[model samples]
Target: MGLTQRALPDTPVGPDAFVLGRRRLRSGFRRSDTSRFCDDVWRLAPVLHQRQQASLILNFPAIPARFRPAVKVLFYALLNNKPPAGERQLGVVTIHGYFQAFKEFLDWLDPQHHDRFSSLTPVDLCQFQKHLLATVSSAKQRANHRRSVRLLWTWREHLADDHIPVDPDRLEDDWNEDNSRARRRENANPRIPEQVISPLVVWSLRFVDDFADDILAAQDEWLALQKKTRRDSHSGHGARRRLAALMRRYQADRRPLPGGTEGQHGINIRHLAREVDCDRQSLMAPASWGLIEQAREDVGVDDSTYLRTEIRGLLDGEPWLKRISYDEDLVVLVRILTAAAYTLIAYLSGMRDSEVKHIRRGCLTTDADRTGKITRRKIISMAFKGEGTPLGVEATWVVGRPVARAVEVLDRLQPKRQRWLFAVPPSSHSHKAPRTTEAKTTKATNNDLNLMVTWINDYCRQHGRTDHIPDVSRRPWRLSTAQFRRTLAWFIGRRPGGSIAGAIQYRHLSIQMFEGYAGTSKSGFRAEAQQEALLARGEGLSLMVDRHEHERLRGPSADEARVRLDKFGDRVRFLGKTPDDNQMKKLMERNDPRIYPGRFVTCTDNPNRRLCRLPGEKDMNPDPGQCKPLTCRNVALTDSNAQAWLQRLAELDARLQASDALAPRVRVRLEEDRAEIQAFLTRAGVLEPADAST
Candidate 1:
């Protein structure tokens, strides 16, 4: 017997069975060629299936019949063909956008031109471009529309050889002499600033390490209840009474009852069964099936308050509330633990959203040396980016202990049969059965993370915690997956002084160590880090120039310093606030006037005139770390740097005066160090003779 012809049971066993039957019935129905084309397009690209269907339904019918086949062909080409190197396949969003543009173009054209394949001309295309520019408010959107029309013209020409020759590229050249207005705008993603990231990092580490066990236990209990409910609903005699008690309590608390029209009128029976780990059939039985009123009266406490109190107690380290049902506490616990795992892995590993979502069960592995001491902990997953060679190419990331622990916790929370680490199992109420797993897609993952942030903040408020994750500006920090990588790059690239972890200073780390995370994509962390580094250099120079203008810095290099500072002031005046990072970057690109920070002096080194060069003569880039300030004419010591030296001398002097038990050699060395700093200060003309006498 054919699968579709096979009779569905008189009463479906569950939601999953009913859904399967409905899908089979739908498939059995004959579909039109256009409908088949649309279905095939969606099947070929599952990610964009829904959007593709909407676009086809809305726009395809409006397109003239003669042009409909051409549109389908274009859609097929885009979906089936491999994109150019470093470019990805056009997503559903882009496809929808293109279709919208095509629809608008069709609407604007004369009725006669719709079916006339060769009637369109360059003049028509040029007019369309002008119309788009005048009508579209966003320059980016205007560009997109123009590009879409151009692509359609190209595809149309390919389909019909006699189609009119129109160079879509030339339309812009003749339209406007001033192209600046139409130029693509810079849309660089900003890094999460240090102030916000520091606290988040600390909290994430603590959550993963300290609270992991509680989260895992909650997950285990939730899963167990789900299993028990499914079992009880089928055969347990008292299932109907328990479900009734739940439904009545839910209603009295002013919570909507389950399973009604629009799903908002009351609680859904399927949803209630899923929540309690029971089958929907068990809940469908009449009120007369058991002593429901008696059960409802017996359970008098408000469900919400009881659940909240029990959760709080569990979070506070009180033993798990044996009195409270596990089903009641499941949702909140699952949300909190999932959020915790996501925060730690995303922030710490610096993986892209696509890459992070690819993390699967058994991804985390340990490597040890001969003595059995673990040397490296790494995550093995597929690299979504730069995977043009072949699909599903494997990649690995070396993760710290905290990230490893978080992955472990996630793995434990997930069902043993599930492959993906971040798979969100379907709820029992869903048409799909429980443990029917799907990997969390990039879009869903991002939305979940944002929701998690809101949930965490609300949870903190309820728990009386003041440390909330703050907004970057006036708007709440809409955490993007890209921000984590860029932020980590900035911290590692421009190592501002403070302990990174315990006694380990960020300055001690090498730039090469973080190059993997920074990446080399035009919009990736590497580019952002370079821009940030340039900004830091410009800000440093601005401070130095500000001091020089005030006559604060005095040194042996003072004359040369004035000349350099004057040049910088002129450049700053020419640049005017250096409004964009790119402007500062352009100045740095012309490297002759570059200023790099050093221990005691700022090196304004030009390789042609460098005084700090060693014997070997080659490339001219300055090694600021190896600079000899006393001899190097390129070095300029600002007043702020000199004050630091003076303060250190003063501290050494105080130590010498206070410590009577100091060894003779130690005392002599301390005096020499103090004398050296004083002599440098005197040479710099910063230490006045009257003050030196004291």
Candidate 2:
């Protein structure tokens, strides 16, 4: 094998080419195979050599002892090919560590037990998997061991392909085609979807920047106060007191002077414009962040003003502003805190959802991290962003004034024993008691804006409000969670030249970090968009029907349905599948009673049921003695009554169309109102003339 009678000297080869070529030839030793395999392995060797580790080399033994030495030799040669000293050792350490893990698997496959090339049967492989899963202490460790096995088989094939004298077919069958390999593959890359990162960082940063000057000043004051009080540690009672006082001063400074500013909240637009690097015009320009102030017609405040005001108010007080516990002024403050926290985390430290969730009392500190903080450490201990592994980012942003105020508010609100930094109190439920303790409670992980929307809607309904809950919804107060976070990202990342928005923000977060699972980047986000899109379409349909009800009821004159369908169908189709629309229509039609059950006259002879004799159909409306009984399905108009009602709708629509005396707005309103009413009545199995007074 060492006799090198070579023709092509110009072939790109590594430093260990002779040794590798000979080893490859001995393994299977075919001229073509050795040439291809040696070059391929040699090219990839730089990557593998960088990952050399004794643990990885040991893992190669799982491929059967016969192949182990050859695989190890290949690994060694790959590592040996590296340029003397300045090269990275990570790649070598990783590959070596990966191979060594196989030894443990091979050890478990005692040859004495079965001895068919020490081949463990599929059943035995299943048992091994069960043993690994059952015995390994942690889910991550079990997952890691399974991953090591995958690398082992991959490396073994590298050695068996060429110069080495071995049966490549048999070796591959023993490894790749085995049940353990399949099971190991499944364990190595589980199909768990990646979760969305908590918006806490972006939210927090926005909150801080909103009060740029005051926050910066407060942070400096807090640091001096911390040093003066000799309470540098985050855990002490003195530390807590100094922190609280600092937060109070911070809040006082952030307060908007009564009738002082023109924009919403106390955020000095002049100051914010400077900080965000946008002109005053862009700052107040119509955008998504501003308050959607539909109620106040004369109010000129844009979304940015509304959001800034709301957010600034929320962040003004403590570190943790509880929206549930706060009044209107404080609610604004809380929202600011939330947004600022999220922004800070995303930009300052690349933290994930798990870390956001695990951030609790005493989880943040101003002290620099000398050593990594573990759970037992009194210092700021962060939950692992990758797995459950604890990570420590040095306290840079924590020293900011806005951060201190946010922390102070949150610290006061922190529940005893693992209380979340962003906890929302549990809503009332009949079946379960509310959990008040931090250990017992769970944080609200949905989009904060969506949650706030729900809270607002529910509160309105409970207080007998009508407009706040859109009348068009069958079930009002439905929320769109994806839009809340996605919109924020989109707004921030929006490119100057894009038609709508190009959300290129948070690019610093690797695709691996954002991907819900390994392969599909858009799968989770797409699913969420589809759901919200459907809801929006449904809402639009309701509004359109309401506007054109009377016109629709006028007997489909001149392809009216087709015209409307064509106009709205494309818009609806853009939401997703047109099939869903057909399905929704079918469901609505089924629930609709075809006859006017409520219009029937009571028969004195039969008191139990009412009889209706209207246009060739006999139907029964049974009375269960209650006025509003569920059995009395006598809706005012049915589909059967629709034909008779069509003429009146047409007449009314015509009058509005021809009207010169009526206000143009009123005439348009009437046309839309009639159309919507007709659709509603048609769906409800109710058709009747408009009220005589109207």
Candidate 3:
């Protein structure tokens, strides 16, 4: 425990001194906190997180004593060594995992006959793999253990005497069978289901767009009162005189004294202090109690609340909030408003949780036109993902008006001194909340989003409304910050032309996520969106196959459509294990140039017979805008397309009925066009022979 500096390993791995701290540490951390990197006990906490997992430590003592020194030296090397694959240093959590896995191998080997890790042979590693198969059932966990051993072998130069002699993985054999089953590019966190997200977003926007003014107004009142209290702290005779004068004015107006809200039914003493320009102690003093009681009895008191902040927010043309009167009421409202702001920025901007939370106070920026109208808005913040550093790089999101307003509201929500926008929600306890950059941890923010949902539902029930965010199977969908980014990608992939309340444009939002939206084209958003697009395409085709909807198709490539769709349906079918997104991705890649569903006509793309392909364009996917629906050889029509054409025919008939609006020649042309469409439908097996002649 008391190992001196001289007793530790003399040579450092990276710097002159070893740097064992994490990459993404907060401010005020000193690398010197642990001088002896070779110490048996080393702190592994990189960032200060609220969870116990953040408090990880390396316990070399737990390993067999002979192996301990070798393990410690190897860890120091791994910690200092930059990744070979052009990544940042291994994640702190990942290294901890490696330590656990490597320990299992050493434990299983119990290689007491050899003093060094390098003494182990390929036969020994093969035996260890056998031990893993017998003991560990989970392929993923077993792969982790084997991967850790592989890491030890990979760093052989640094290991020197401790390095293994042969490749422990032995790629020629099926030793990697456990890892072979693993899928690539699959996210562990499930994107929120659509039913939950739609209503959840609607309510979140309701709080932000409809209910925010009332909340912010109440916050302003609180700040003003706080300013008044801070300005006049003393409770001397001068203060007493001011208090008396305040009471006199109250009496002159014949109005009752302000009462407390939030389940309290008494005159607000703090309100009196704020009004009278004195410390609360002055109003609370025993000697002044009698005078206050006398004034209260003569002038009466309002039993509800002191603050008369008018609620300016409207819902369905009426005030959303009944009254922002009570101190508790205001505090709760501010928190809900914060959650709402978090929701908007997270969902709409396609930002990760940490990036959204790390947004600084003044991150929002705008580009205005020459006439002073705003053109584009963006948010600048730190991006931790793929920046290859502990502290993330500065990144920008080209956002819309809603995201801009949310950032503005967040800037005003927290205390002015707070550096981070997502600071502690102001409450009676913290006295305007601390000015710290870190507030809600991941779990805390998750709880906040869920609680906001609960609060919203309670509000809707009280207001006798039916549009509450519905639960999935009698329970609310558990929300995390993880869901929003991927959920936005999903929506962007499937419904680019969709609109929410004529406010949120999915088409514009999808554009903003890609390379064309901003100069930050190298950002990872484009990949996420394209991945979701492929999944959406495959999912739609698979669903259509499942419903047997392709049976009604009428087109030149109808047989090819059925064959491709049936194969896609089989590939996606859950024989035993449901395929993950990554597996589905692989399936879709092989089945490219498949059916593309459209509103007007389903394109069963055939390259040779194609009519929409541009002269020089080599793109396999047909351009839907250039689609020759009526004459193209690729065109297919399902029952829905038939109905769509029928609706179009009815509309054309209505237009042709407008005799005053059309000349004889134009009417004749219209009739000919109608006849052409009717005949095409009849030839395509959509209508009977008599209707075609008519």
Q: Which candidate number would show the highest TM-score if scored against the true structure? A: 3
State residue 100's C-alpha deviation in candidate 3, in Å.
Answer: 8.8
198-249, model 1: which lDDT tens digit per residue?
Answer: 6566555555666556556555555554466455634455665566666566
Candidate 2 structure quality by residue, lDDT tens digits, 591-667: 32122122221111122233333223334333323333112233232233454455657777788867898888888
lDDT (Cα, tens digit) per residue for candidate 3, span 357-395: 878888888889999998778888877667666565778
In model 1, state the lDDT of residue 651: 92
Candidate 3: worst 10 consecutive residues by lDDT?
Answer: 1-10
Q: TM per model?
A: 0.69, 0.29, 0.78
Residue 80, candidate 1: C-alpha displacement in angstroms: 6.2
Candidate that beats the other on TM-score, 1 or 3, i.e. the better one: 3
- Total clashing pairs for each candidate: 9, 90, 1
Candidate 3, position 88, lDDT: 41
TM-score of decoy 3: 0.78
